[model samples]
Target: MDIDVKTLRTFCEVIRTGSFTGAAHRLGYSQSSVTAQMRALERQAGAPLFHRLPNGVRLTPAGSTVRGYAVQVLGLVGEMEQALRGPEAHPQRLRLGLAPALAYGEQLARISRFGRRLLPGVQLALRVMCTAEIHTALRNGDLDGAFLLTARAPRRSRTPATAGGPDPTSVAGLARARTAVLAERACGTAAQPGRPTEVLVQELEFIPSTSASTRPATPCRQVAVADPDCPSQRWLPEFLRLRAGEPPESLELGSMDGVHATVQGGLGCAMLPSGLARSPYGAGLAPLPGVPRMQWTVSLLAARSREIRDTHREGLATALRLALEHAA
Candidate 1:
């Protein structure tokens, strides 16, 4: 038979408190209300569960049997309620997608703080992917939210818009600006030959590749070939495509550390973020003249339903807004 939890609770409370008046007081109900509830419970059980006695009220044999079950059931119900509402309840899991470029700066710190403050019990899952991949994941529901580049005003229309319309004013816009400023400062410094400094520009050409052989070759330069899969490497072809002349010739190295070592050895320049360049490695590197500024934005994406409860999405957006204000 279908049974209401309230009925069970009222029965258990009356038994524990030993009187209808006491149960009403503990449950914040009037004694009359408590009496009515017990009457209802007795009707449901098809028997009078309590016997009126001189001292107070005593349980009949049937009442005593049901009270045992009621106690256990009510105890379980109370525990379940507390578990759902408790401060120590397990956090909801949230998946967050981010572009490699934005992961390097204050975004990380801001997001961390936002999580600690706003979503204390959230389990954050971070995925670093390219802009295209992030968008795809968001559409597929594999990602609850993402930070990627946006080119135009976000519209509610079915067709997704392209990138690079007017400059954005959203949280993503601020991130782009911050990234651009960092890129500009990091790339502006041109490296001198035989200097013990770290350079923060991407190595566009590595040893006899199309980029290296075609670009205009500079003198007194050492170059290291980095992994093609690196985000820094992905930007090189585009950088060269934008340049007016032939690509420069240079050595190809595998890792970021190798490129740093090469630059430290006074071999050639390496493109890097200003935060990294200005850090310990950039001790002596100076900005090059006329370095083009480059910035990218990361957008948030989610289905309507999943997006509603996405704590990370909200937290990231808040953090992005704060970062933009501070950067501004």
Candidate 2:
């Protein structure tokens, strides 16, 4: 079967992600495009490759056989390309990932411009995903770098870089990464009002929802949280439990936007990073009272094993700082 490297790469991504939509997102292609590419690959192979399922695609027997050869072919192609282009040659592309919450506004535009300017001919690709996914991609070498939004410097963050020669799981190299304090605001309920402020918002009432008909007196102001895998939203539940002595009513949303919309609609309240709370994402949401204000840190991170030139690292750091400053 005749297949090109680009098509092979797309096939691998689909297999890796287990869904056309996910592969499209990672490759920056439309979902339909990914679907068409897979169909074409199947045509070439003269057999079906995947069994479509409600949750995700599963490989067929034919697909499993193709995968072994495809991997070998891709590895050989990579080796050929590397040999053709001397080891000392400059990198032509850099793939970077960002936490979903920080992937909006002009910050991305600013970073893109700076990246192009710094690398000259290098093509910079940015993808938005959960922090855990970003870390996984960096460790797998699918991403050259990432921008992470974390609650704050936890004790583990104090881990020293180079202690064991580039541990991807620990905060080793990332501890010294250039960090920006996104915002310091109260972590509590939000609703129609002005932007987040130093003061804890106390205007929200426990309005009961009609959906909770079984218990009329029960408060409908559920705690809104993003997907479980999202690092930025992970702290809300525990904080609520600590403040209220029990788990508050929760409304799990698929995305940060959904969480913000729920709170803005007066249906629920959310505890989030103060910076995200102040950005346009949290616009018109007032922080609730009782919950303490917390600081959120956004860091530009690179894998320690990746040999990024100091100039390139500084350029990326400067871009992030400038973006934050301009946003401010």
Candidate 3:
């Protein structure tokens, strides 16, 4: 038997509110209309969905099964309607994420220009985010794909198996991810003159205190990090404190450019992706001492499933690859 969409919706609302009266209030319908619609729905299904309790209503086993299918149907209908809204109503849209360190670089502007030129009529929006947030958004379906910087998970982010399974979209647990390595660059500590030239990001560990082993060779450095939770360098403060065993003095700057400039000005030092550290923009700062050489990987990642396998996605990925190669 065919089910009317309106009646199905009313049934779901009734189950949700646990009372016909409440569902009517929520749906802006009268009590008589709600009862009538549900009665029609029950007649079509040939089953009584609710057991009338003195306090409220309870779903029969069949109602429980139907409720699951009702949710799925409604979701599909919503998707279909959105798709049908057409360019006149809802323009084709894609949310592309990039780490701020990458966003402020030549890559983002170039890719955006190229996308506008190549994919006419597509609304390509930019989302600047930390690598971790980018991964989380990708998993949650908030972002379509991104140029994400990959790094090791911080100590606090790790947990035992029982706590929860790894989030599927997280970089560590990314399974159905289709990706292309956009670029590979090492991260380094930004230094002033006379500071070490190639050390690990955890600089304070090399310096010994009263309880520690050796004194710092250079001046105790001030570190500058980005303030926004989504900025590429947001992880620096934590990484420094945890890995270095002793935290250095840190300053939080508003933007990635601010962090770069602050490091170059001899005001403080910073941890930077090699791309940023070596760029002409960062010429004033020197590399820290001792080459720990941890490579920061930049990748264009999309969900492996049905979310992003289409002409627009393919075009965006291709545009990114070509632009990055030419820049390199």
Candidate 4:
């Protein structure tokens, strides 16, 4: 009948990390102490919260219900603390992560400026990272949230599931692959609805470099960011194999600018976000016909244990959406 905020906090941490050991490490407590807190919490709730698993724990239905309330309770507690301390006494510091592909031109600067003005007393800390690193940082509680470029799920109406439907292995192979990997897995799991919905920001076209010569002597190479194995960039090599009729040679660049520069120099063609390809920076690039379009949604992913205020989170998402639009 009596559960304290500290217990709820520990419970949320366990859910965020998916293990008591991880929660303990993050909370600077002994694993046994975390175990005791969970047991006590279960006692207070009069039901099992999590089902023990070999690798980690999973929330039972009761646990899931408890978690929903726990998050709200914690948020209210946070708001109370903030209200009592006042904005000046406890300034909000949001550590946000972003992918390099989304930082073209002056977009990063634009985001920082807009975020500051919108939040007023808040400090916006931004880190440019690859998709994989961003996900990892979010899980580990190192970042408050992240803006990722995710592939949009195909509309149910647009998707055909009837008999004699389009072959899954046909020309739309890359599109199907992208949907399975990026949309259903990355974007789908990253943000839950209501708390902070994923905002559709931009659509990207993965174009083959026009700079490639038509001569057979000049083979088109696949250009990608250094961390091409991440979900967003991972499909490029496969796309090339399907598009070019062979496993094309690949050129890796550390930054999006470098990739664009190399591709424009005719070294190779890279899959580019539409924002970058359509910008003044991409003046020389031409869109590849018959290529399927992938829409990117900016997901606001934060540690469930440390929820950003709903207003603040939504405002930041709006700022990002508008900033990207202006930059584009």
State residue 294's C-alpha deviation in candidate 2, in Å: 1.5
Q: 1-328 in candidate 2: lDDT tens per residue?
A: 7788888888878877889999999999999999998999999999888889898886654664466456556655754675577757645666777665554333455566666676676555666666556656754667767766543443222223323222222321232232211221211233523212121111111111122112433333477765444433544455445445676677775444445445655666665433335533344455454333333455666544434555555666666656555544
* Candidate 1 lDDT by residue in tens digits, 1-328: 4568887787767765668878888999998988888888888888787777565575553564465456445545644664587666646656666554444323444454565577776655555565555545654557766554343322221223323322222323333344344333322333522111121211111111111222344432333434332333343332342343444455655334344444544556555444434432243344322233234233454434443364545665666545434322
Work out the TM-score per prediction. Answer: 0.40, 0.48, 0.45, 0.56
**lDDT against true structure, model 2:** 0.54
lDDT of 4 by residue, 165-258 (tens): 2332343345445434543443345456422244454453343344533343454565555345343455556655665668767666645655
* Per-candidate total of colliding backbone pairs: 36, 2, 12, 0
Best by TM-score: 4
Candidates arranged by lDDT, highest first: 4, 2, 3, 1
Query: Candidate 1 or 2, higher TM-score?
Result: 2
lDDT (Cα atoms) of all candidates against the true structure: 0.47, 0.54, 0.52, 0.62
C-alpha root-mean-square deviation, each candidate: 26.9, 16.5, 21.1, 18.8
Better model by TM-score, 3 or 4?
4
Q: Candidate 1, after superposition: displacement of residue 36 in Å?
A: 74
**Candidate 1, position 170, lDDT:** 38
lDDT (Cα, tens digit) per residue for candidate 3, span 238-281: 33444456666877754455565556455665655544455333
Candidate 2 matches the true fold with a TM-score of: 0.48
Q: Pick the lDDT winner.
A: 4
